[model samples]
Structure formats: C-alpha cells, structure tokens
Target chain A: MVYSISIFVSETQSAMKFGGKIGIVGAGALGAFYGARLYRAGNDVHFLVRTGFELIREHGYEIRSCDGDFTIKPPVYSAPEDLGKCDLILVGLKAFANHFLPEVLGPLATPNTVVVTLQNGLGNEETIAEALVKCGVHRSVAEASKQIIGGTAFLCSNRVAPNVIIHSAHGFVRLAEFQGSPKERTFAVAQLFLDAGISCEVRESLAAIRWEKLVWNIPFNGLGVAAHQADTAVILADPELRTTAVEIMKEVIAAAKVNGVDLDERLVADLIGKTEIMGHYKSSMQIDFEAGRPLEVEAILGEPVRRAQQKGFSAPRMHMLYALVRRMDQLRQSNLENSQSRSS
Target chain B: MVYSISIFVSETQSAMKFGGKIGIVGAGALGAFYGARLYRAGNDVHFLVRTGFELIREHGYEIRSCDGDFTIKPPVYSAPEDLGKCDLILVGLKAFANHFLPEVLGPLATPNTVVVTLQNGLGNEETIAEALVKCGVHRSVAEASKQIIGGTAFLCSNRVAPNVIIHSAHGFVRLAEFQGSPKERTFAVAQLFLDAGISCEVRESLAAIRWEKLVWNIPFNGLGVAAHQADTAVILADPELRTTAVEIMKEVIAAAKVNGVDLDERLVADLIGKTEIMGHYKSSMQIDFEAGRPLEVEAILGEPVRRAQQKGFSAPRMHMLYALVRRMDQLRQSNLENSQSRSS
Candidate 1:
C-alpha cells in the first residue's frame, strides 16, 4: 500500500504546474532571489520594495547565484496598494518585520491569493494569523483555498545589490498547509515554487520541520550574538561557544517537544554541519547585529523558552543566554538611539 | 553548658599573649593595618617589604581609622631572611601574590611559628601548606601550621602616610583556626587585635563563613568586572543589574551547597542586600581591573565553582559568568602584554 501511494505521489508531482505570477514583499536579497528565479522561468514576478531598495529595482532584478547568474526586468511595485493581486505573495521580510506584514501585503492578498511566509522562528504562522484577523479576514473553506501557508524556514545566504541578489547557498524551500486539509491551491503554489527552480518539499509534518529549523537557529544565531562573532563556522571552531550552542540546541529541542513537534537531534546536527561547509556564512541574526537593525530576539529566543516554561520545562541555560543576548541587543539599540537623539 | 564555657573563655582570654613575634609579608594596606595594630599593642612586629615600599616605610606607619589616627615606627625587613624568626606571621597580600609567599615569607617563620593566612577563597590554606613543605619546614602538625583565616575584607577610607594603611569602614576582623579549634594562642592573637582597638572575631565555622563571603563577593565582584561599574551601590541600584546579581547569588549558593557548605536563599539575599547598603564600595576585582593589575580570578571566583563542580554541583550561571569574566580579564591582559611587547 505504501509503495503504491509513493508511486502515485511521484507521478502527480511530475505533472504539477511550473509557472505563475509570483509577488514578493520586502524585495531584499531573499525576496529578489525567489522573485528573479520565477521570473527567469517565465512567471510574471513582481517585487514590492521600499524607498531604500527602489534604486535596485530601477535597474532590474539581478541574481548572482553560485550555480549561475541571471538578470531580469520584472515589473516592480513600490508599495502594497500599488501592486495588483497575484497568484501568490512570498513574505520574505525579517521575522521582526512580520508585525507589519498585514499592513504591507494585505492590500494585494485577494481571496484567490495564497500567501507564503518564508520567515524565521515560531510565530510566522501565528503572526500572519493575527495580522489576517486584524485585516478583517476569516479562514473558511473559501479563504482556506486562498490561504497563507507556513513557508520555508530554512537557511539562505543572499544579498541585494543595485540589480541583483547574490545567492550563495541553494537551500531547499519546504511548503505545507498550516490549517485543515491540503487544498488543490496548496499543491499549485508548491508546484509554482518548483517551477521557479526552487526545490519544494511538501510535508505533512510542517510544524516538526519548522521547529527543527528553529533548533538550529536558537543556538547558532545566539552563539553569534553572544561572542559578537560573525560566521557559523567561527562559532563552531570555538569549543566554549560550541558547547554552549549544543546546550541551547537541546533547549530548543525540549521546547519543541513540549509544543508537540519532535525532531531528530542527529539530523539537526548534520544539517548544522552543512553550514560549516559554506565559506564564511553568518546567521541572519548576526547580519542584523552588524546592520544595526532590531533583531528577532522575541520569536527566536524568548518565545520558545516561554513555551517550554509554560509546559513546566526548565531551561536555565537557554534563559540566561536569552537574557544576555537581549541585554546586548538593548545595549546596542540604546547606543544607537542615544546617538541619534543627540544628533537630532 | 554554653554559659559555663563562656565564663571560662572570658578568664582565659584575659591572660593570653599573642605568642610569637609578628611578621607581615607584602606590607601593603592590609599588612600595614594589622601589623601596626599589633605593634601599637606592644608586640614586636617585623614587615617584609619590597624595595619600593621599604623606602616608604622609613616615614613610619600611619593608620587613619574612623576610631582615631594611629602611627608607629616599626622594624622593616626587605628579604625574608633579613627578618629574624617570628612566632607568628601574617600573609597580607593579594591572592595572586601568595604564589611567591614561600620564597618571600618561608625564612621568616621559626619552627614553632604559626602563619595565619587572612586571605580569601578556598585552597589558599593548601597553598601555604605547599609553601611550607617547599621551604623544608618540619612541624609537629601534619599540615603546615599555616592556619588559613578570613579577613574582615574592609575598606580603608584614609591612607596612612609613608605607605601605611587606613580604615575606611568600621568593620571587624573575622579570623578562624583551620581545625575549628580554639588554641590558647589563637585567643591571645584575638586579644592583641582587640587591644589595638580593632574588633576581632574568632569563628569556629570559618569555612562556612568564607563561602558565605564568596556568595557576596562573586555577584558584586563579577558584575563589577563585567560592567566595569565602579561602585557596588550604583550597580545594585540598577534594577536590571540587581536582577542579574540575584541570579548570580543563587548560583553561588548552589555552588556552596555542592562544596558541603549549606547557605540558604535568604542568607544569600541578605548578603547581597548588605553590599547595597555598604554604598560606594569598590570590589577588589574592580580595583584590579582599573589599575591594570592581575585579577584573582581562580582563587576568588574560578576555584569555588571548580571545586563545586568536582563535588558534582551544577553552577550554570556562575560557570557562565566565570568564563565571561575570565575572557574579559584575559583579553585585557593580552592587550596590555602585546602593547608592552610592541612598545619595547
């Protein structure tokens, strides 16, 4: 029975659609990479960017990937209201930026539009849910057909230029239905991602997978913040920090288990090892730290520990690290804010 | 039974002589304070000083205390051999300096002499023992007659002129016998301290008291090092820092319990509160940090936690703080060392 079902699934995947209109909000490196890929594959990809990033869109959408380089002059939208409704909207802004997703992307998310949140941490789906509710939207069978899916929370190394997003790491994009049964529309969106030359893994256990990504993130991202060190490989090289990272990873695992998402520790460790193979790549949190932007501390560090504590699980080490990192972030923020205040 | 012992103790205390010539190694603020106190009370005192301090001693010892000003011209000895045999010697130096206590103070002690170590932390008594054995001193006591004791560890607000010490705060001297037994000789030493107008307490539970003192020291001293904050009151007044201090205190308490010294949570909190009340006080660690002097990391902070861990105690917070503070200290030391090397 299992063999027959597997064969049937393979045949169905091969026959899926490969191209459609792809709308990307927060058109930075990650957004540009996904948008430009679909555009190059003959899809109508539109990028919605802010004033800071609009300069890049003026030239064109350019992607410098390790595999290949591609450039395209896809239609670019500067604001949510400026763009018309599309088949799918990929939310690629920072996890901290998720709070404003509904305000920025709501105008373009029609009843037929399926929004894919490819952001970090535990709250992407919940943040979108709350935002949708604030936008006066309900999740019915009709709305479910045009729903917001919990998109890939995996690693990606990409950066934006005047006309290109250099993609160094070709990480997979996993897609899944966040609520209820998988509709035909869910499969269509996954098919569209595959058509864009992005590997799409549709899994029934999306929570477990998203949580597994979090297990990798809490430690590596935190290790970077704690040491004020940049890359994942550098952190792993320091024995003191590496042990701390493992402890934090175990904390995330315990939290995930409490939240009903079981993950294989060895598999997570193996996945983490792959990042070391990359040439001097940093976690997004590290990048945020250097950029002097607010970090995803709440979702990535605090929320999971809170969840664990809610289930009466003690995570002293993770909590202490969280406090230290939060203080560090605050220290940086206060310095920036103070300097700005003085200048103004 | 307690009443009968108290009556006998009072009568025995009256006739006790400090027994032994007084020897002070280091002859710094602590050494000057205690040695001058003993000498003024009419006991023969000899100070082992460096070349720099030896010249300063010619001006005479000055001790400015809240009680009154005390000054005296005591005999000064440079090398350990220059000093004749003394019945009792006080090791009055920082924990780091105690490493050389053997070469410096070894020759000054007679066969019957007792070295009372009024130093901080665990395993210091052992350092003295090793120093004695290395000096080829044979005593009837299996362990070296180096009875380790805790100091009042007080503040001297006023500096005695000519390189002598002053008393900033009116705190008492806390000393103890290694075997928790009251020697008629220990009582005599306590009397000399009393005669000098310095309050002294002979404790039976010295180990427990020292650990309690550490529970106080680690939080304030560690934070002082971490934040580079100068005053204890200022650090404690900060709500965030106060919270961090409390967490550190709990870790120390746990460490103490692991080392077979049981300190309750209330006692730990009380000790923390006492530091806050002591207002405007600088920790020894903070003083070392500011002066570019080597910090007593292992003896004061590291060894206690290390010993606790050896006894199977988990001091996660303390262990983390110790690593960070040690890193900071090492980083500073390396920077200074490199700069000096480059300059030369």
Candidate 2:
C-alpha cells in the first residue's frame, strides 16, 4: 500500500535543517522511542523523566525495534526546568497529566520555540495554549497556537522496563501547524523526524488531519478502553462491534462535517480496511487502563463529543464511549484511592 | 410507598389454599431468598443446589433480610431427580444456565405445575419453553409457554455464604401468565408469593411488565457490566452516565413500541429516580461477570436488540451495550481459561 506521506524533505532542504535542541516533556514509550530516534539522527534531544530517571541516567535507554535494535544516551532530566529553553518541545504526556503543563511547558519553551504536542484526541493544542497563557509564557491563545504544532504518531512502541523501549511496527507521524499557517519551522521539525528514519508529513489541514486520525481513534481506542479484552483483531472479528465501529466512524464523519471540518469521509473505509488486516493490536487506551494509569478520555472521546454538541450536533456512539470510558477512569481512580487508604 | 399485590386467592378460595410441594431450581440468591420466605410461611419448599448441597441439606438456608432474619430447614437436592415433581417450580438460575433446563426442569415439573422464571432481562420464558419441549415434558412451545410464567424480580438479594442469603431491601415481583389468559393458576402463584410476605402483583400487560423492568435493567444492568465499577448509584450519580442511562431507557421504550408493546415512556425518569436512591446496587450481570460466570448476553441484550431489529428498528445504544458487555464476558472467560491452564 502506498502511503501518501505528503512530501519528503528534498536533498537541498535536508542540509538546511537546524537540528534544533528538542525537549521531550513525557518520557514514556512515545517520548523515548521518538526521542531516541531523533537523537540517533544527531539531534540534541532532552528527555524530561521521573520514575526511571536514575536507571536512564546510569545505563542510558535501549530500544528493541523492528527497525533493528539501537540505544541512545541522550540528555535526561527529572524536571523540564533542568532542560532549559528548547527550540522544539514535544509533549507526550497522557491527557490526564495536562494539569501539570504549567510546571512542565513554561520553563521548556521560549517565544520562538515550536512545541509539537503528540498527545491523542482533540483540544490538546487548545489545552497546551491555555496552559501557556495561564503560566504567563504566552500572552494570548493565538500566539500559543502559533507556537504549537500538532503531531499524531503511528508508532507502536512500549517502555518495557525502566530504560528499555520496544518498537513493534509503525514509526511515523503526521505533523500540522496546530492552528496557524504552515511555516518553515514546521517543515524543519518534519525534516528532523524524517532524519530519524520515521516518516513525517506536514499537512496544511490540521483539523482535517486530527479528525481523520479521530475517525480511527474514536471507535478503536474508545471501544478498546471501554471493553474488557478487545484488541484491534477482536473488534474487527466481532460482527456487532465491527458494525458499531462503522456506525461510530460514520457519526464521526457527520460530527466533523457539522463542526465545519472537511474531513475526507472515505477515511472511514480506509481505516476499516486497514484494521481488517491488522493483527491483534492492543490500543494505547487499553494499555494505560491495564497498567492502572489514567486514560486520555477527555482529550480523545469527551472533547470531540462536546465539540459536536457545542455545534448543535450529536454523536451518540462517541457520547456513550465518553461516558463509559470516563466511568472506567473513575472506577480505577476510586480503586487506587481505596487501596491507598487501606495501605495507609 | 404502598405495594398493590393482587389477590389471586379469592375470598371463597382463601380457605382452599394448597400448601403444595414447591421446587426451587438453581438455588442462587433469588431462589434461596424467596424459597426460605415461602418455607417460613409454612409451604413445602425444595432447593436444587450444586456446591452447598450437603450444607443446605443439613443446615438449610438462612435469610438475613431487611424485613427480618429467618432460617428454614427445607428439603435440599443435589439433582432434580431427587426432588421429583413439584406443584410450583421457580427457575431463578442465571440465563446462561438455561442449557441445563432440559435435565433440571424435566424431572421437577408435572403438566399441571406452573413454572415461574425469575430471571433478569428478556427471553427467559422462551428459553424455558424451548428446554421443556426439547425434553418431551411439553407437547409444543405453546404448551410450554402456557405452563411457564414470566416473573420480573425487583429483589436485592445475594448468597453471601453457603446456606446463607443476604436480602438487602427489595423483595417484590410482577408476575404474568406467559402466552395465555389471566388464568386462576397465575394469580394463585402471586398469592403464594404474597403469602410468603413478598409483594406480588399480577399484571395483565406481560410485555409492558418486562419492558418496565427493562427500563432499569437495560441501562443499569447493561452499563453495569460494560463499565468497570458502575453500581446502580454510581451510574445514577455521574451526569454523563446518567444521560446515557436515560438514552438507553428511551431506546428500550422505543424497542418495546416497535414490538407492539406500549410501555410508559415516563418510566425512564421513574426508574432513574428510584435508582438515584437505590444506594449502591450491584446488578446481577455485573455480579455474574465479576464471578467469572458467563453473562446472559444473548437473552439480556442481544435478544432485545435483535427483536427490535427484526421489526425494522435500530437500537444503537443497546447494540453498543451488547457488544461491550459481551466483550467483558469474553475477557472474563479467557482470563479463567488462562488461569486454569497456568495452574494446571
């Protein structure tokens, strides 16, 4: 299958790359995998980590990948402030962790620094913008939006251990200029990713891109998290779930249209077809839930549902998914609280 | 609130009560609770048990209910053959356990015996009828449905220990003459329940009765299993989930309409209001899923959804629910299998 990866960096523009200092806000699987890749491509990458900081600092990070194994000894820190100002700041934290953005994003970005948020779902760019303004980093939401880029990764990577990442299959992303005009810096960031052996696409249609990604994410990720043991194959294999998935996609297309976004409706078929042959793939939401971590419920499901509702439209499937996934998150939180109280 | 339990025993027949043999099939919480109630009321009750057969046979069953505490040394049987024939056979097994009915129901019921199925969700009557016909205990489905009675229990009971039942609050059921006129036998069964101090109402609108019970069941019971930690109160408490519960109730009402059953649509608010004050109720489906027992997915969810679909109507919420809950059941079964294999 030919992937329309927008445009690759031309030979001339490759030399024009700045190889900017990149600060990764959340050094989970996505951060470590992509950060290590960029670092291997000779970019100065800094990872802001917490739990595995000591292990990473001592032994560095390792990647067991489908693209052959590799390791990188990039700069690692326990706080974003320690990383100083960065030319490009990538936020890979779970959406539940957005409340910590004031502390994370403020010290990591200058006015000129471009922030690429790789978080899933909608309103993330708006969230980062709000955080920037709240922290007095950016005076206005518009300026924050201008300084931000939206990234939707197709990477299949997991932080197996303290300082180890397993890259299974996909390793690429589609980048957009958040809500601003496509500028030279956007392509420069794309070029950095391209240099890391990960396909990068800079699309002018950020809303279309996000909604397109949501076409797949809303049904698969939302249902995967809501269900007990549903992976990609299980979802596709089950007739009822598959039908519900198609209906959700159609509703998503309708929601996008009602929200004044012109997403290619055919993306539904493309996604369904792609997923039909895809093997048993556990969604990130499922993984987060299984690991007892908070899910990206708001960013992925709730925001989109609310967005459609705001525009005088309704997506029942998405709305149900939002409520259910949110409930699941609540249950997990309550369990954690109960356990902690008992232990204490 | 006062309950109106219709008197099936007329003034002339009040003194002609037949304290006949009553067989309690699948002596789970519901069966045990009501059986003990009847036995306490001076009726001959027999329990068909599995695990705690010897315990129940010796110590009998105990009920710790809100009404009062009681114990009864009623007869207990490991198999239906030992119980012989009964005048009234109440099948309170989980819907998934209906497969054992040909063996269980055959030996326990005579042609004159009225079978009251106190199972949740839809299609219990149909399943019992099919099992009876398959075992040659009945001539046809019509005869089987005639011998069977539809029961919707509003009871809150749980078998906490061997030979012990915890009846939390509610202990009432709406009984209907399945596939027949309001015969004297149906009211006699209701009278029996009323005699046991359990509220019993004989409703002519069998469809309306099931649909009304489904107003609460479809949302709370359905969502209870689909979600991670949703009890009745938790579902009623969350605004998003509350909205979803209402939507599902609406769909159930609509499905009933499609099936030529006129249910009061206002029952949605009534059930929600009741559930809001239900004080952290766990649904039977949720219980079954948690206990690693197979869920009544087909009878409880799939049948109703398909019934609506058969009439050229679509129940999106029900379909989504059926898929998710079924997935939860699948996950549970798989987990059990995995654990069993590992232990082996």
Which is the leading candidate under TM-score? 2
The sequence of per-residue lDDT tens digits that candidate 1 reaches over residues A1-344 is 11111111233655655355668887766776777777787887788877445666567766777769877887877777778677778888887787787687567766656778787777777777667666655554345433768766454655655465677766567777777545566676766666666777666655765777777788777756755553777656655556656766776777788888776667556755676686567888888888788888877777777778898975666665566567667878889999999999
Per-model B-chain TM-score: 0.89, 0.94
lDDT per model vs. reference: 0.69, 0.84
* RMSD to the hidden true structure, all candidates: 5.2, 3.6
Model 2 agreement with the true structure over A157-253: per-residue lDDT tens digits: 8888979999988888888888766677778888888878898878876787788788889998888888765889989888889998998998898
Runs off by more than 4 Å, candidate 2: A1-21, A42-61, A73-82, A161-163, A262-266, A338-344, B1-21, B39-51, B54-60, B74-79, B341-344
Q: Which pairs, if any, clash in model 2? A: none
* DockQ scores of all models, one per candidate: 0.28, 0.66
Relative to the real complex, the DockQ score for model 2 comes to 0.66
